[model samples]
Target: MTTFTFHGGAGEIGGNMLLIDSPGSRFFLDFGMSFKRHGEYFSEFLQPRTSNALGDFLNLDLIPDIEGLYRNDFLSHNKMKTSEEPAFDGILISHAHLDHLGYVNLLHEKAHVYASSVTKGIAEALDELGSGSKDDFVKTTKSFSYYENKKGEISRIRNCRDPEIKYSQREYPLTVDRGEFEVGSASVQIFPVDHSIIGASGFIAHAGGRSIGYTGDFRNHGSRPELTRAFVENMASSDLDILFIEGTNIDEEKGMSETDVGNEISRLITEAEGRHVFASFPVRDTFRLLSFYTAARNAGRKLAVNFRQAFLLDKLDSNKALERGKDIIPSHDEGLSVYIKKREYGLIGEDVEEEEKARDYDKKERPYVGIDNQICWKDVRDNPGEYVLFLDNYSVQELVDIQPVEGSIYIKSQCEPFDAEMELDWGRIENWLDRFGLQVKRAHASGHMSGGEIAEVIKTIEPKLVVPMHTQRPVLFSDLCDCEVLIPEKGKSYEF
Candidate 1:
């Protein structure tokens, strides 16, 4: 018999942690931090979990009560015990998204971690870059093992045949002792999948005469649709017993395709009279960037990206068209040249030219060419008709403060939570726009599949059981299939 438990993310969008236990082994699908809700129990005083705050997990029900699961040194001051079972044999990370990997810092040294090579790289970079947290989520020297295939005896036999053969395999492998670990008598395999971010993957675990499939956050519209399809086909071919899938778009209407969204953005940029500024989640979909590039080219205007945006694009292997610089504003003499912000100029030092430094020239010495300003807040201030801005949720308020000239437009191009309880700040954007009478447009595309697309995927996979996750409405599964829609509550167990 096999038992499954939902510790979190059962009916929520984040904090996804699930436990599976079989005869000889036990494991966790993910251990993630929950985004604090306004006025919620832990929302008021919750800070990033520090070594000193391990006791807070007990009060907040974040971490489970697993005896000997974690090292004693990692615990907080006030240690309390719960009736919960011991920790699992290992942890399987599906991706590097903070929501999916946030709680990793809380685990013990004994917990083996697994992730794709690119996911691991990005996670390490995030730790080094210090975007949100200052400390590395995963310890630097901490050891982890990687699994490429989910097959049982065949995979093990292949590993034993030749040590050299294992090291030379296509996938990245971290050397570890397999005999030291067993998860509910099941072997685990991590399979790559398509998502908005690079290096996302799904997971397959085999145990107790059954196979379970967990599709981590995924999208079929990215560059790897066939790869996503192949994963589903492989699962269907393998005859999976139960499949856990994300349903982020289960309640959203069918959204525009990536291509359509790009075209709409292009149209908006081309029609706008003032300077254009765009702020978006700068990951995946190089096609969107290309759309902006093409539109700028067609309009005979230069493209401009912020320093962080330029850095991200360069990391993605896209730097051919960018002009390295130390200023947000471009030279008044240059024709259609892309300008990067100068705030983090030292970070990318020596590579940028001295002449590109807008700060070098004295205020009175700088030559002013109105039309030559490719990118600049000052350009927007002096000649708002010459630039366009693409703003994100974070920068919307700032953009509102700019108070652009008449006929300026703003476009929102990503998913914004519509829940009344969430009280997202974007809701205020609408009211602000109404107050200002600014012309606002919504030109966006979804990263996840629509209802019809998800239904198609379900039909293609044809699993014995379908478990929907990552949405407010898991009941949507009832519309697609008559099979058991197992909505396992937190801490409740389901047996097979």
Candidate 2:
């Protein structure tokens, strides 16, 4: 018997953790963070205690308590029993979205991680650019261990700053080729799928003489609808015993495509000529970024992205050939510019005293400070119509410096507020826009298949059992599909 357990994503829309136990193999699908679950205990000001390590996550049921599935440093330091060998075979990550790959660094070191090359590259870039107390994704920093100082006193080893403590790089086998790979007793195959973010994939695992198909998150309305269609066609002939599908948009009947968003943005930019335009969207959604880039090019304006997006674009361009045959816009494109916001002390450029601006920005950001395509607040303010500034709510403070002209455009190209905290943030953004006399417009597309599209996919696949996940309305699957629908309860085990 093959047992399937729902540890997180069953009753929610983002936190996805599925444990698959076969006769001789045991592994997890994805170890993601559930926004709904995390919001219950932690907020913006209140965060999980780093001193407690995994204690907060474990106690709050944010992560499963399965043995031999967590990091060694955390387990031993927290006084939890340590395992000699990793309990699970491996983790197959579908994409780089936070909801799908947030908690991967917390897993056991010996367990190999399987993901696409683009996903690995994104993880590496994020880890390199991330500050605060974040551990690395490609190479995790060792934590909570102790060592003897020169004075013969015991002291806890800090992350990577200490020369003796090295970053741990685990075995992350690239699945970009979409070839068959062995995971314990199971054989797995990967397929590229369309989603809001790049490097998204679907998986099919054959173990214990049973075939299971899992869709991490997909939509047929994005720029690459053909990718989703190919996955559906392949699954239709695979004789799948069970299908695990995302139902995020299972209650909605319609969806907008990325091309549509691009057209609307072009029209808006054309109409807002001779004035500045600013937009906000998920930075990782390279397709949406490309939409804005194309729109800016058509309107004779450069798209100015923050340092994070510029860094990510450079990384993606370096690994474009490694991706699943998708071409992303190059970071060095003439129509693209890196926006360098004034850091601490409000100092930028060479004219400022070096000593005063030394502590303003991180070393990673210093390299692009004076680059040819870089733009600062003064540059944008002097030539407002020459650039389309990309600024999210977190970066809205720059508005005070740039001071966008009246009738300037502000495009919200992401999802609407899903929770109260987000609603409050949106309200704050509105206040900023209103204060600057900016005109706000929403031109975004969702990253999931709509109810009608999902129904069509279900009918085409024709699996024996349909299991809905990554959704709040799981019961709706029964009405949408002709096959047997199992609405899994959180933390329960089901067998086929």
Candidate 3:
């Protein structure tokens, strides 16, 4: 018997938690946060109290009220039941996107965590960088071999966890990607897929005379389109009983291919005169970063990245698999400069002496050494035409310092508004551009399969039952696909 339930991400775009049970053991495909769940009760200032861990989540229903799967320490701290027995086998992560893996922090330490080594590495790096306030959660561990650090060679990561822990091999299971693995009665195959973010994957689960395939989040128009095709071809022979897929962009406008997006941005940057080029895309989108780098290089300008991006590139290089594929990873000399925000010691608008600023800056080793590839707002302001700046929303204030001249270019190279909050933010972004007199040009691409493209993927898989997930418009898929469509409802269990 095989049963699966959707705790979240059914009829939504983000939070994805799926629990699967075979007769002998149980496993989870993802334990990501649900935006719908988070938005319902909390606003910016109003958040769950830190003192109540499981109490807030379980009572507020952010996390499912499951037994034994939560961390014993956290549950006990919250005065909730902390079962000694294990609830399920393990968790298999599809990608490093927070919507896909944000809730992993709340899991019991004993429950196995599985993902591609690159994903684990990136997750750890993000944790180290302290993004999204995940410092308290996100316990990701990986085994790497540093045969010799004397030469400063980055260690090679071996594998991604397959949701089982064998203490005999080491204290923890090797965090590596695997081809075939077993969890009780179910045997599965993990395969890589193309995505905007690095280390995205899909998996095939086989058990109880039924075969199912799960795609975490994938796109056929990424830099590695072949990988997506390979995933489909690899599973074609299985003749799947059911297929669970994501539809993040199903109800929205179809996106452009990465190459086309690159071309559009390149043309914009190349044609701009007497002004700087500024663009903002999701920082984790590895290919988008490379595209902007290439565009800057082709335009005879250097790409300036923020402190966080520089840190990410260095961490990525430490992983052998990802490092080898990089044509240009951010560094001081690789047409990349680390944008160091001018430090202010006193309250807002309170000016300090040049000596104070210089002395305080030289005293700190954090955010990379200032002497190496570090550019301040003044340097960029002076040399506007020589640099292309990668700006995230948080760093939007740097525009006041850069003081982009009239006719300067700003490309918003990400998808359009998906929600009210996003539309509000978009308006603020345009307002910032208007305030600075920067010319706005929008050139963006999505990181998911379109309705037409998804229809073709269904044609290839040929599953008997097709369940639409990670989408708001699952009904549209029925018209797009030829297979029997199943619209998953939240917390509903289904049998195959």
Clashes of each: 15, 0, 6
TM-score of each: 0.71, 0.95, 0.88
**How well does candidate 1 score on lDDT at residue 190?**
66
Candidate 1 lDDT, 257-331, residue by residue in tens: 666766776677778745544435343333454445555555655454433333344343322222333101122
**441: Cα error in model 1, Å:** 1.7
Residues 1-496 of candidate 2 have per-residue lDDT tens digits of: 8899999899789899999999888888988889888988989888888867487899988999999998787788788988877898999899998888888878887778988888888888888887423545667666766677767777766633554454668689764546688889999998888889888889999988999999999998888889889988889989999999999999997867898999999999999998989999998888899899999999999999988898888888877444422447665678899988887777864476655565688888877776789888888888888999999877888888888887898998999999998899899999988999899898989999898899999899899999999999999998997899999998999989
The per-residue C-alpha lDDT of model 1 at residue 123 equals 60
| Lowest lDDT block of 10, candidate 3 | 163-172
Off by over 4 Å in 2: 147-155, 159-164, 320-326, 353-359
Task: Give the candidate number with the greatest TM-score.
Answer: 2
- Number of colliding residue pairs in model 2: 0
Runs with alpha carbons beyond 4 Å of true place in candidate 1: 36-39, 42-51, 68-73, 76-87, 131-135, 140-185, 273-303, 314-376, 379-390, 393-403, 420-424, 428-438
> Residue 210 in candidate 1 has what lDDT?
76
What does the lDDT read for residue 150 in candidate 2?
68
Candidate 3 at residue 447, lDDT? 83
